[model samples]
Target: MSDIPAPELAIATRNLSKQFDRLLAVDNVDLEVADGEVYGLIGPNGAGKTTLMRMLAAIEDPTTGDIYLQGERLDPDRPNPRLKRYLGYLPDDFPLYDDLTVWDYLDYFARLYDLREPGRSRRLLEILDLVQLIPKRDSLIATLSRGMKQRLSLGRTILHEPVLLLLDEPVSGLDPIARQQFREIIQVVREAGMTVLISSHILSDLAQLCSSIGIMELGCLVESTSIQELYQRLSQQRLQISLLGDNLAKSLDRAIAELRNCPQVESWTVGDRQLTVHFNGNETDSANLLRQLIQAQVNLYQFQIETDDLEDIFLQLGHQQTS
Candidate 1:
């Protein structure tokens, strides 16, 4: 009887490393990304995030190791058109044809991807609409703004509807509005079953978009996990308690006394009319603590849990520096 094949991952790497003379740009790292996942990569300026991605995109050769895409082994040294066809990579500086109009630019890439005739025209129109370039379809590439160019490049990247999308600092120079639009586009693609591997300095965006994240530093993958798991394991819960009453001092005193008796309350600080507390407890514990506080007549106006975000977790990890 024949053995059943293992289920394929969207991406997998084993003992991957890249060295440039004395510098080890990417160290021995084993990374995996499941299908239909949006994985965010983040680290400091010299953290080797870009190098790692470059190797994955097959733009740069790894000194050692193996890469697998959808269970098929990839050899960057040899031409693998089949594997390449399923990958869409948008590097930091994507080259565009300045002489071509928006429609012509996408048309050129469509032909390169072996898209032909009526279907090619239809796909180009759909891509232009997706990237919000329908109105600018006739505009010269050189006449477009930076944000428009970014979106256009993204449209080009997804022209062939690749299963794996790799974007490196795609939102680096965009303003808030552009970033939001780009983020929305990414969500649309992700919903369409594309596995995206994105790297950026914008932690907040990643916190919102990625199902999982990988942190790299000093030519190594220091950490990788689902966003929820990362938060549940590393994040500390804090409660902001605001007191309301004419006699604020008395309410504050009572609140402090109540907090002292609560074991879930690790520590707390008093402000003008609020208390910031470090709490290490579950939802039940929080409820009990609230009940106790209310019974003590602490005049509580607000009791809100403030969980640490991705930036906070990243800073707390202390793995920002490459060295």
Candidate 2:
């Protein structure tokens, strides 16, 4: 840490590392997380994801390296108390007090964080509203569903309006519907201008929420890229079509034959009256293909471009590493 002005990057780390006895948990790493961007950290079981999170949250010190938040030094040895005003961390297994009501729980945290006066009460109501827990404010924490508790935990994190949020597996153990709801909450927070760093093994979920992703392997950040750029680098565009009308099998046979011969379509598969095509073509070519189908009198029920999924992207990267 130094008095000299640091670079004004949102979150910057220079050669950060962590050593435990003979093992290096986090290798020399340089990272930059831009302001207002949702950055996801991903890796396998022993890839040091938790350790890195702790280091960033100022819970543990890096063996060597420096961290800067908005161009100011983040000293692990002497972390500033005011840093809490700008940062919030949600660990993987956050505990809760089942004995307290939602309002009381928040009020307790507000006081612990040294929040003052009428503002603290106002912020509590605002957060309850944001978490959709206004109705549950009087309800005991033990009476709430897992989803509600998750949102409530999130509300606790945002009580002070931190600029950066560090969430580790925030949606773990959630059902599909719950996961979707959690995603929506995160989207709202992102729109509110908070930069976020999340860690999760679920690539699909990260795909939905993250603007960019970083992959870790053997204690190193192997790759870092934007979602759009990662998709382009990993695979071509895909188009899925569901055909309608009678003679459906015959329609698909004709469609597959013609589509296979088309220069724009790299390959295609047909099943359940649906066609999935790997296409690497421009919009003009796509439009022309649809126009040709209409001219050929093929009944079109649904035609949509399938976005590249993160599972395949992760697999492709795995294969590349082996190669």
Candidate 3:
């Protein structure tokens, strides 16, 4: 459905694939993640998410096809030493040096990235402040809460100033408040001009933070859509018309009888004074229905239209593919 041309892709894959012996892990997959864009990858378990992530991180080799990082082709066999400087991979279970203080922990990573002199200290301080761990710089990693540890791990990932972040279920175990805090950190990273490929089953969070999304099923990318376009394309609604006056039961019967044959209505529920129509049509159809009811002398008070939620659209897409 996307007709837009992609002239600038931060991470692009051409016919990417992977296989474990006779088992096909990832099918021919093509993706283009834009610069500074938060692209959410979602699918059920065993959807080849981890396989794809490993390939992206150069931990696993693709059987065929090319992976371009920042528009430069990456050869897994002879991975460019500079590639590590431009990429960061944070798995679901991010480990932290439990014995090291927050400052020392981050300092360790900074040194590993060869962040030297006063610039290293400046960058470490900036990441601490960004992750809201400035006050905990002296606190030991073992003493920090789960959410705090998550933040610290994230800070380590960006300690080297990587251009792209590959995060798998980054907020899986956080509480609501913690999740929001993590979201803020990602927003900050985006503002600082970093592209991210995040995989998670937490659809609501993805819906909120991601600019575009890729839906994978059976190792195939079934759909790729922008959040804006997805909302517009899948926004279906229901209309409930409430009637006025007495003899409410009679009114419902009349309305139901008249609407029983209308294709504009998919299904409906009738109450004493209300007719809840499961409408799969547009505003014009709604207006026509209202006019028809008015002309038939079925007095009504309220006509409410309600759009379906994101979960509905997500489930429907999966169902359609399987069906």
Give per-residue CA lDDT, model 3, range 1-323, as digits (tens).
Answer: 13232557888888889989987789988888998999999988988888898889888899997888887778987859897678999988767888999999999889988899899999999999999999999999999998999999899998988999999889988899989999999998988899999998888889888999898888888878787788788867788889998877666767777687578898988775777788877888888887777777787899889886566778888889888
**Top-lDDT structure, candidate number:** 1
TM-scores for all candidates?
Answer: 0.92, 0.84, 0.86
Clashes of each: 0, 0, 0
User: Which clashing pairs does model 2 show?
Assistant: none
What lDDT does the true structure give each of the candidates? 0.90, 0.85, 0.86
Worst 10 contiguous positions by lDDT, candidate 1: 1-10
Ranking by lDDT: 1, 3, 2
Local accuracy of candidate 2 as per-residue lDDT tens digits, 116-166: 998999999999988889999999999999999999999999888999999
State model 3's lDDT.
0.86
Q: Of the pair 1 and 2, which is ahead by TM-score?
A: 1
RMSD to the native, candidate 1?
3.1
User: How high is the lDDT of residue 216 in model 3?
Assistant: 86
* Poorly placed runs, candidate 1 (over 4 Å): 1-6, 244-246, 319-323
Off by over 4 Å in 2: 1-8, 239-261, 267-277, 290-305
Candidate with maximal TM-score: 1
